[model samples]
Target: MRDDSTRNTIIFVVCSLALLLLYQVFILEPAAQRRQAEAARKPAAASNTTAGPVAGTLPGVAAPAQVRVVTRQEAAAASPRVTIDTPALQGSISLKGARFDDLFLKQYRETVDPNSPPVELLRPEGARHAWFAEFGWTGANVPGLPNANTLWTVTQGSTLTPTAPLSLQYVSPAGLTFTRQIAIDARFMFTVTDTVANTGAAPVSLAPYASVQRQGAPAHVGHSQIVHEGAIGWLGDELRLIKYSKWAKDGGMELPSRGGWTGITDMYWLAALIPSQSENVRGAFRVTKAGETNIFEANYVGALRQIPVGKQVTETTRFFAGAKTVPVLKGYEKQFDVPNLNWAVDWGRLRLLTQPIFSFLEFIYRHVGNFGLAILGLTVVVRLLFFPLANKQYESMTKMKKLQPQMEELRARFKEDPAKQQQEIMALYQREKVNPIAGCLPLLLQIPVFFALYKVLSVTIEMRHAPFMGWIKDLSARDPTTIWNLFGLIPWNPASTPLIGQILDTTLHLGVLPLAYGFTMWLTTAMSPPVGDPMQQRIFKLMPLLFMFIMAPFAVGLLIYWTWSNVLTILQQYVIMRRLKVDNPVDQFIARFTGKSRAA
Candidate 1:
């Protein structure tokens, strides 16, 4: 029976590893290559198709026929644009439709390369994958109320900057004058104050509406589950996120929100429409199909106000278009009363653990000037925090190691009497005052912390292009140096190898860091007492190798933290074993390496 159980355990482990390899080769690698290929195939010029008819657009509105496919430069130059220059933003607001379609984040870049272009937040309407924020007034029984197609005239500012706000004006033939004041802060928030003056005799009822619309889906959609990449909103104090696929399947969804915001979010960038806190609004996440394109929109409309014959009322709405940095989001949440704006970070259900871990990591990184070092420091802090519990657990393990001889004897003596062997083992344990489960306590406790750190590393933009020691340019990415190509020393690309290229490069391409992790894990396992069953001991011996393969594709920062943690655990166990005078693998390893007796 024991032999059969051991065989089954080995079989299960082998099958799991096989399935993992298959999944990486057949699913993950293929999907990644396909997405990259698609991005590469996209033309620089916008397609003949238009990304028009966004939110606040009238039903049955027809897109223009000429299908103006132009470059971003042509799109920006085709219409007069107001320059948007700020510490955090650089772009132009198109005067044609008063749309913030040409915007770029000044801080972040497309790559770590200094010459790479800054991150483009919003692109021109006629450019590929066009995205922008458009706000307008929708009035009942009122025509020509400045819809998306309406061209507005810039009134005051030549340039929109943090210190200066731009004003735009549009006068309807019916005698109502619409004025828009666009103001931006030092960070990512943009506040638009719209005022409509009733110059005509008749009163006009208008509902202030805003929408953040993205044409088609992202080039690389459904890329991450850890970070939200679709329609997100906070309505009625409840935060919501709907993926692009979900939106397409569900058609549309709406929630009544008072004083909240809704928008489209990328992995690190966001464009949200914030309605006034006092105004009751209806938020909707809608999808519209035009030909082969799907237009995604997050829009909200405030309560309609009746503008009297000679009186004008003002309505204020906010727009956020920038990186989803922690400080900026929190600042906006506090200053503008944006509800649950931090949800933009996608903290997951473990926000309680993830938030603190992220804060601690960021705090350490600021002082250390290295994100990789910060992760190492964070691991040390975590280890110290759990030192007391781990000490007790290691001490118990030491005691168990001391009883190995007696346990072996009992097993031999009760070879035919299994029940008596169990009884003897329990008696021996009670005599030694060793809890059999103590070794598992620290591991169980670290699971949540491990997942929290993973969440932090996966979602935070600060770690996106962070670097570590030699050969590690981006800690957020997998180790680029793989042993299969002699750590990139050889003039060979494992990924370009025919047939099994991706599978070999992704799974079997061992990195220096992963090898270090495996070694530390092996040492930590070696210091522990061997299992009573020889087969079980053999299976346990393979755990380090199995885990090294499993974690090979994980982020380098996580691998660094985990490897450091293993080293710390081994050191702690060594100390406990030495103090308790228990036989351990550390002494043997040291003596073997030094060619001297451990006592000497």
Candidate 2:
């Protein structure tokens, strides 16, 4: 009886533990995930004003005494108007009614009027100097919603000032709510707190959306741009261009419609205009599962809400808006998605190896105060760090070239038996203590590094509009310096045939750096082993030209790094060849390096 009781107690304890684990993994986790998703979808609702007649009653014989008293009482009960003092910033504006125009733009001007309608009340004042603004919809009644009416009232409530360290409460039509405020530290960064609540009797279902429409261009034609920390995507009328990112598709999906456009980052910023009612409105949507959340931007136009009668649900979210400036974006570390915007470095496994290169370039920028020089410094540092490895590979290749005669003799000796030929070659390699794979390691390691650096230079905003020495104006743009023209009509022409001229212009004339890059590539290949097969030689010879063609349209800063790296490698190889005497007779070279007398 005692043993049975002990066994039952142990079994009960084990069962309870198992049940707890199951609850946490399956039930509690999913519920927590749903709550987080709701947190991210804090929809911005529309504001409302009290209905009233215009002031000054018309010429009436007598006004009701009771009506007059009620009117005065209603006026006294209205919320007092709040005023925002303008800061010292030159482009500063004011906040008053709900104004949507106060939202920031990457490269455009904006304004706001305080005396506009209720919708205009959402318009923010003092936005010109602010990094971002909460505009578009505020209050209870959202525009374009069917069968739903809203009333909004503001009261004399204290708000956390810019200098205040603690959160403050402001009474909206719903109830008192806590709001967090973030200061704009730079030109491109702004953050705001989101306070949403289900101020009704039951649970409220809310779907949040954000949209931006530039005034000057149509949606598709305009450059719809987004930069998260390090990744950037842009949509032109014809193509969607994207930089490097962890995701397979760097450039976003192409749009079918030529007139309207929607852009979104998977878990970050999203924008889309409300679609017309006649169109099949598949509105913008987002979902979160576990800890992963996905945000979508679509051509949907409508509000989503299900507010119960009494229960209150609320949420807070932060927004960072502005240009894709690294320093500015880094300041708002929590708000921006791609801090440092390093996603442009797309080399799959080599991203880690090449990160130091960017760090070195940034360091150089700190001292020299110019981005172009920083690129040059980065090139020098990379070349020096890889010098030993590159030299070792080149030396091995040189030895392979010298062994060619011996290898050919072995091949001839066993020409009829391919298996025997390979065995003999392996034997010869072992006897000579030569490693064929040694020549491949350096090149293999460099491929990914090269690709990653290519991406880094292409999208870094610090290089945008930054000037290098001489005629080069922007490191992030194609090089503009040119010497002479082969054809009078061709722009920035180099001395070559029309076809060759186009190629050269595409590669070399984009900047002086690419020309330097091509020259170094040519030199490096000159010292490399000559391919024995005709087809292989032809292919090898075309590599430099292919690279030049590919790099012509790339940003000049990348070209600078590539060009300098190639030049340094060439110099290193030249010095190694001279010092080791590999350029001379093979027998003598072996005697010196191996300390062995040649077999006579």
lDDT of 1 at 356: 92
**Segments in model 2 whose C-alpha atoms lie over 4 Å from true places:** 1-97, 100-186, 189-318, 334-357, 384-388, 408-428, 481-511, 584-600
Per-candidate local distance difference test:
0.81, 0.41
Top candidate by lDDT: 1
Candidates' TM-scores? 0.92, 0.51
* lDDT per residue as tens, model 1, 1-600: 332343355447555755764576457766766875775665543365655556335332223233455777887787788999999899999887788899988988898776899999898766667788887777666866776567899889899998889999999888889999999998888999999999997998888888788877887774554566889989878998898878878876887988888999988889988888888999888888754567888888788788999999999898999988998798888988888897799888899999999888889888989999999999999999999989988987788778889988988999999878878888888888987666665776887788788778888888888988888888888888788878878988888987686668966868999899999999988887777767667877888887788778778898999999999998899888888888678788778999987861
Count the clashes in each prediction: 0, 38
Q: Which ten residues in a row have the lowest lDDT in candidate 1?
A: 58-67
Instruction: Please give, for residues 1-600, the per-residue lDDT of candidate 2 as tens digits.
Output: 221233244335434544553454345544655554564364221011122111111111111121121232232233233222112111222222111223323232221223322111111211110111222222244222111011223332232223422222333443323233333333433233334444433343443322322111111211112222212222222223232122123212423321222322211222223122222222222211111111111222224445454443333223333333444444533334322232322223445754566666777899999888887887676666676887777776666556768877876788898778778877776786666656555655665666567555644545556778776767766656543352244464453457676545543454456566766787677666554445555655766665554555557877877787777777676666666555533444478989986642
Q: Candidate 1 vs. truth: CA RMSD?
A: 3.3
